[model samples]
Target: MAISDVDLASLLCSKICHDLLSPVGAINNGLELLEGETDPVMRDRCMDLLADSARASADKLKYFRLAFGAAGGFGEEVDPAEARQLIETLIDDSGKITLGWALQNEALPKKAIKILLNLTLIAKEALVRGGSLDVGAEKGDLGIEVVVRAEGAKIALDDAIRSALDGTIASADLSARTAAAWMTRELAVENGGDLRISSPSATELLLGAIVTA
Candidate 1:
């Protein structure tokens, strides 16, 4: 099933907007509190909250621009460092999820980068109780291999998202939550590759992609 470009655009927009809502709402809330708070200590606290919310909002926007928008200049390949930075910024907010980034490649095809970003997004979401997130990419006989592993006290991956990542989602039933995963799966398929997810238990998750060069 081919998704029209316009529909794809809409889905990507929805995903970005949805992810941003919380941080953006926080910024709004902080502003509202600041407007009425006259106490010295509370004003300082509100400022701190505003700063954190603003930073989070900026980080999310940066992640989404690379993951869903036309970024990385005019190049067909993107720097691995850039992707690492984006993911790092995202994890910085949680202050609980530790990131172990091991990228051996200097760069990868943009489509592969997109797949990596989306997979990272999914893995990050699965770490419900904060965990270790290990993300790496390497080249092998199988092609460009992107692997992400998340282990925590609690992990929760939606079945719908898993289905979307594995190209098992019914096209008519796709929703905002599965949009990024579905897009990742399609990109891998187009590149002669596929996506896989393994969650042996509630405490662990592993996402992998093998995209042919």
Candidate 2:
């Protein structure tokens, strides 16, 4: 099955909106609390929550603009250090997810970067019980290879998401799994790459992509 660019853009936009709702909702809740509270300490807590939520929302927008939006600045090639920094910022702002990076090359194609970022997000989602994620990218004679691994005591990946990544599910529903899978598939196709996944058991999951040079 073929996916149109319009469909891809819509999927990406839907994904961004879905991710932003949490922090934005928190900010709104904090505002509501402030309106109801008279205590100075409670007001202060609300202010803190508002600030945190605002910053997190801003960070995600900035990252998503470059990753998914129409920003012409990111050329065909991306700086590895910059990419790593962006990913780190996302992980830090999102909270509770640890990321480890191992890049053999200093740069990679833009499509590969986007795919890797989406994969990282998926891996983070799988670690609901809190786990570690390992990300690595290397350039080979064939092309670029990226790997994302999540290991935890309780890993629960939605079946819809798995189906999307496997290209067996459509994106009409646009759940977290479907959105991530759609984004990953779009990037892979744009760069002539392929996404592969392995779920050996309930507690472990692995995702990888390879793009032809």
Candidate with best lDDT: 1
Candidate 1 lDDT, 110-201, residue by residue in tens? 87788889899899988988999999998889889999999999988888888888777887768778888988888888889888888468
Q: State the lDDT of candidate 2 residue by residue for 90-199, as single tens digits.
A: 77754767778898657677777777877887887788877678899998886889899988887888878887787777546555337657667757866777888896
TM-score for each model = 0.93, 0.87
* lDDT (Cα atoms) of all candidates against the true structure: 0.87, 0.79
State the weakest 10-residue window (summed lDDT) of model 2. 171-180
Clash count (model 1, backbone only):
0
Against the true structure, whose TM-score is highest? 1
